[model samples]
Target: METVEFKGSHDPEKKIVVSLFWTVRKTIREEGCAPVHIKRIRTSRNVYEPEGRKLLKLSDDIMEDILRDMEMGNTVEFEMTMGTESLRVLIDDKRFSVEATRTPEIEKEIVEKLEHETSKLTPDFCQTFLPRIFPNQ
Candidate 1:
């Protein structure tokens, strides 16, 4: 597994850590990594740079390799450093409690926050981490 540096997290750490294999959506939402993978991209030719102006182009073989690598699912795991949450509600004397992962509302809110955090990243870090995943291109 390859590790990537993502500078757009809410974490106060000087260097924001990110995982390369995590889904872009999941990574942005849960890990708080910058989703700037291709947000501010303006491409003229085959190769284009992210907002930070670092040029990047995945070779045909490298692209194929990536796709192939992703074919298998559910391989990565994270240690749950943060504990889970429980939400409770009472309606007309009926009581209900929901686990954090069971509620759609909370998940949506998390995604929204992740999008906002991801948008804060500087484009410079975009190209810096990509080459590590697809080298020898």
Candidate 2:
């Protein structure tokens, strides 16, 4: 099997974006395929608080839940919040929500994987992937 491992530092500025990207990339690579493109949507600001942190922890716990659904060749949804801040990601019909937090170690692999997968896409493919992955904003 081809194992694509990613390593890097988790700079807060781009941690979440990087992590999500890598996760998608790793999934594609492990499947011996690549995505047409990967789009990243960043909230205007970071939301951090005690309650929000707890929720973020929960979100992390559900990472496997998110991955399993995605692995079924189905789209997965994610709703994330930090303090009063929140964002929702809808892939096909699957959906879930949680609070956001900074986790550099995990984010590093995610970002790298995303970059690797996206690098395989053609411009035309990216055109379609971007809109679908990030819709309405």
Candidate 3:
């Protein structure tokens, strides 16, 4: 079970889990797998049991709820699985992490993808301005 993680604090807007979820959805699509379902959700207040125990697809609405929960100071954690590969997401206030139980190759791919996406979201201010002023001569 390999894992890749991202910290929300690093994000300028602190939307690390949002970016992580997008990456996960993209990875699932790229791997040609059907949409993954939420196996379970554990929140600070209570355990949310999805109707029928497995019908809850992780959608934008669910994400919104999670964000709302976080805003209210409730920690949210959930697990989604695709076959033998499972991804666990833990979000608390401004901190977030993901644990992926997948092949090393897949894990590395997720890390690279997350890094690339995060780079776009949080650009280095110094690097951006320094290059413009110095002009690589």
Candidate 4:
């Protein structure tokens, strides 16, 4: 399977994942595909700057949670899939980690383990969620 990944230094304050998590949340809700649920997380800042890219806040508890997920060997990851394309984001460390991704066959397995569903959406969803990434056809 073809894959694209974004690797970056982890944020100890857990702000990176917070933004990543919200990105997944926004994609899922706006896509309106499979049933996916998310916690009502409080962001340090508004996602939309009104004229800029989305920004989010990282919290202490989120860092703890990421540690726990890694400790359990099941880091909190999300998958977003549309047709043949997909994205998979993983945030399991503060010192260093990766970002989001799309749902693959492992969705069921991950969901069963974390009690979290795979956030999925249609191809059209990308047009809105990531216009820069997937521009209009």
Would you list the C-alpha lDDT of every candidate in the order shown? Answer: 0.30, 0.33, 0.53, 0.34
Candidate 3 lDDT by residue in tens digits, 1-137:
33344443453224534444554554565455555556777765556556875465444455556667877866687777765667776665644456676643555565556555554646222223222212241
Compared with the true structure, what per-residue lDDT tens digits does model 1 show for residues 1-137? 22222234333211112222222333344435433332111212122233365423344543443333333321111111112322221111111111133334544443343334445753213445555434452
Decoy 4 TM-score against native: 0.26
Tens-place lDDT digits, model 4, residues 7-121: 2433322333333444444445435554322222322322211123332222345445545555554435534343332445444442222222443433333223222212122
Q: Rank the candidates by TM-score, best first.
A: 3, 2, 4, 1
Model with the higher lDDT, candidate 1 or 4: 4
Every model's TM-score: 0.23, 0.27, 0.55, 0.26
Query: Clashing residue pairs in candidate 3, if any?
Result: none
Better of 1 and 2 by lDDT: 2
**Measured by C-alpha RMSD in angstroms, how accurate is candidate 1?**
17.3
Comparison by lDDT, 3 against 4, better one: 3
Give candidate 4's error at residue 39 in angstroms: 6.2
Give the TM-score comparing model 1 with the true structure, all chains together. Answer: 0.23
| Model 2 TM-score (2 dp) | 0.27
Mark the regions of model 3 whose C-alpha exceeds 4 Å error after superposition: 1-17, 23-31, 57-65, 72-74, 121-137
**Model 1, poorest ten-residue lDDT window?**
89-98
